[model samples]
Target: MSHQAIYRKFRPKIFDDVLGQEHVTKTLKNQILSDNIAHAYLFSGIRGTGKTSTAKIFARAVNCTNSHDGNPCNECEICKSILDETNMDVIEMDAASNNGVEDIRELRDKVKFLPVKSKYKVYIIDEVHMLSKGAFNALLKTLEEPPEHLLFILATTEPQKIPATILSRCQRFDLKRIKSSVIVENMEKICQEINVKYDEKALKLIAANSEGAMRDALSILDRCVSFNNEEVDYETVINLLGTVNYQVVMEAASSLMDKSIEKTMILVDDILNSGKELSFFLDELIICFRNMLIIKTTNSTDNLMRVSEDEAEALKNASSKISVDEIVNYIEDLSTAQLECKRSLNPRVLLETKLIKMLHGVNHTDIETLTKRIEELENIIKSGNVPVARQSAKAAPSRQTAVHNDFPAQETRKTVVSEHAVKQETSHDTSNSVQEPRNFENKSDEAIFNAIINGWQAILKKVRSENAGLQAIIRESKLTEVVNKKAVFEFDPKFTFHINAANQPKNRQKFKDVISSFVNDNCEVEFISKREKEEKSNKPKQTIEDIYEDLKNEFGEEIVEFKQED
Candidate 1:
């Protein structure tokens, strides 16, 4: 006899043999026991989940002359006929190939005829979603009210594509993807039965790569066995799948956490030179990061992190060195790279680029990254090393502020000034801008403005929770200055819609309420155009040391301290 693939050779002949789908099989057996079988059935799930196998078994069970516990006795003539494909009563059709209106019409005409040898004729249509609209419509009448001697079993990976009219007339059963542990156990049994030497870890690696598909797992196992029929081990499986081992994965993750760019790149180079696929390695990297995150968050490995004790310990140690936020960002970057890797011709470069980015630094624009930076600054302040600017005679002095005589009071105004229009609108000399006059000498006002600037991200987060639309609009506006009880926001002239949106009566009030809660004062909000802001740009830019000194002054010595070296 010719060699048959393991998936086909070890195909489940009975419902009891189907793995990880007890909820479906048990109900089916009960239906058989009660003799309450439906005329039409719909089986749906991902591939290799045993939809067609279950359909075939159920068809045989209902026709078997000698049956036990809702199972078919293959010894019986009718059962053997169906198994051998000689029986005309049980017809299996691949709807993917025969999905035309005429095909369903042919089947509809056949439903009226009685079974040749069996009690009922069963029609199993796999990939039923591939049927055309006209084909589905043609199948509807026959499916809805088929002859008592006819049975229709429809299977599809996507049930949503099936017409509701066709779905309503059938008994639907959604099969689940088989678990990895179950696949491993079954594969181990196959190895023993075939007298092949194997490593338990090798079976697990295969199972993990199979992604909860029994047929995929078996197919992978077949290739591994073919490569070395005498034995299957971790090294063989890893090489066959083009994926790195757990040790390499852990080491790569460690290098990333340590920010050792050279070491990580060398590892990537070595893996590439060894003919390992970058995409598979990327997948391993993602799983490795996910496991570490799980360990970091839950502090437990039971049923979560699918690794050995040593691997779990390594993950725990590595996870300790990184924060949850950083790990999440790394996962996000790697996941995005993974998606792009499929389309890129040079996946190696893409993979290396993402790894380098994760190592270099976090995106400062991200809210979590900004929050982390603020926390780091606070820690520096508490440590008493806040920098102080050195005074030099030649250095420019702080500019003065001349109050605007026409400043509006108690009401918010939108200033849509252009470069040419600024002179006419301000109506005052701007060598010393008027916007800063109210807070120029009052250190308390300066402190309040600084405090709001530092807590800007938090305010945005609060606004996001309450009103996402408002937060989105105002996020583009910079809090340039806070004078009196009013807060001024500067928006890019192109984003004038943002200014207009924030100026609305209801949105403006909601934003005012949020800002008031943050500053512990009833604050009025104002939006200004970028052109108007530029007109008041006479303030001296602060040096790095000067900014640190301001932070120290605002947070106090206990929270922010700085030192200067001569």
Candidate 2:
């Protein structure tokens, strides 16, 4: 006999055989048992979740010659005929290929006739969303008022694309993706039934690779079986599926955590030499980081990952050495690299750069440490362990000025003064020279500008610390001017709307508090457009309640509350 695909050969023959969809199966069973089945039924979910298979089972159950409870007796001729696709009463159509209006018109005309050899004439349409709009319109009336002996089963992965009119005529049931554990368990059972020897680790690898698709898992197992002739090993499974082994991923993660760029690069090179895809490597790295983050953040690992017990324990050990923040940074870097790799001509270079960055950039330090270091340096300077350079420079001018005061006769005697006294006299003379009228005025102006700059810096720091979302919007805002207790702020064009929205009364009050604490004034804050100066003046505004009361006296109770804040 020719080889049959695992998904096709092992398709669920009955409701009990369906996996990961107990809720749907139970509901359908109840409907069948109570004789309350709808004329049109819509089954929607991801592929391989048994939408089409469930429809076939339902067709068999409804038309079974020896129906028991809600299941079909496979021994019955009707069930055998339906399974063999030889029954005229049960029609199965692929809407993807037969999406023209003429096909739907023929179906509509056929639904009018009674069942020829079964209790119900069931039409199972797979990929119903692929039907053209005209085809949908043609099938609408017939679906709404089909014969009692006729049942229409529409299966689709995307129900959103189906029209509302067609949806309204049917009862919809959303099937769910089969969980990884369930797929693994079912694959093991299938392996046993087929006399295939496999390990649990191999099954998990296949299940995880399947990503919640039972058919995919079975197909992967089938491929493994074919490659090794019924004795599937973990290595064979990985090689057949082109999946990175968990150990390789773990080693890569460990290297990253230890900041071992050499080891990581070697591992990456090895995988690349093995002809593994860079994108797939990146995807695996992302998953590894995600698992690490989960292990770091959560205390329980019951349902978090689908790895075997030993693998989970290994991951937990790896996760213990790294912090959650580090994992998050690593994931973000890899994710960004993945996006960039898509657009780059050479993805290997991008991948290498990203790995190097992840290995080096995991250690993050904040600005607070730098600020404290600066403060420490200032304190050391203020402790008087060393003479101030500015003061020493001033001594020269002081000595020159003192020479002018004492005249040429004392110049020689002044040179013989003690070093301390000489230094003092020099500092005094330098102070006198430094405090010239014009120079003092310039210093005062500079001091004012410095103060304003410092105040703006403080405001920005507060905004970033308190409101990250807002800070992300207003990337760089500069203090344009301070006139008559009004602070003018100029924002980048990208942040114009953000600044305007934040300047609303409630947020403006918060901004005012931040600015007041920084500049030592309860000043009015005004925002000017970046391109033009249309200053929004902040004046003491009346409350909306007050305005409402005034309007109420003029217009009675019909007056409503309305207020706008600038």
Model 2 bad stretches (over 4 Å): 1-4, 362-566
Q: Which stretches of candidate 1 lie over 4 Å from their true place?
A: 1-4, 299-310, 364-566
Model 1, CA-based lDDT: 0.76
lDDT minimum window of 10 residues, candidate 1? 414-423
lDDT of each: 0.76, 0.72
TM-score of each: 0.68, 0.65
- Residue pairs clashing in model 1 are 381-559, 381-560, 382-559, 384-561, 385-561, 385-562, 386-561, 386-562
Candidate 2 per-residue lDDT over residues 63-172, each given as its tens digit = 88777768888779999999899999999999999999999999998988988889999999999999999999999979877888989999999999999999999999
Candidate 2 residue pairs in backbone clash: 395-426, 398-429
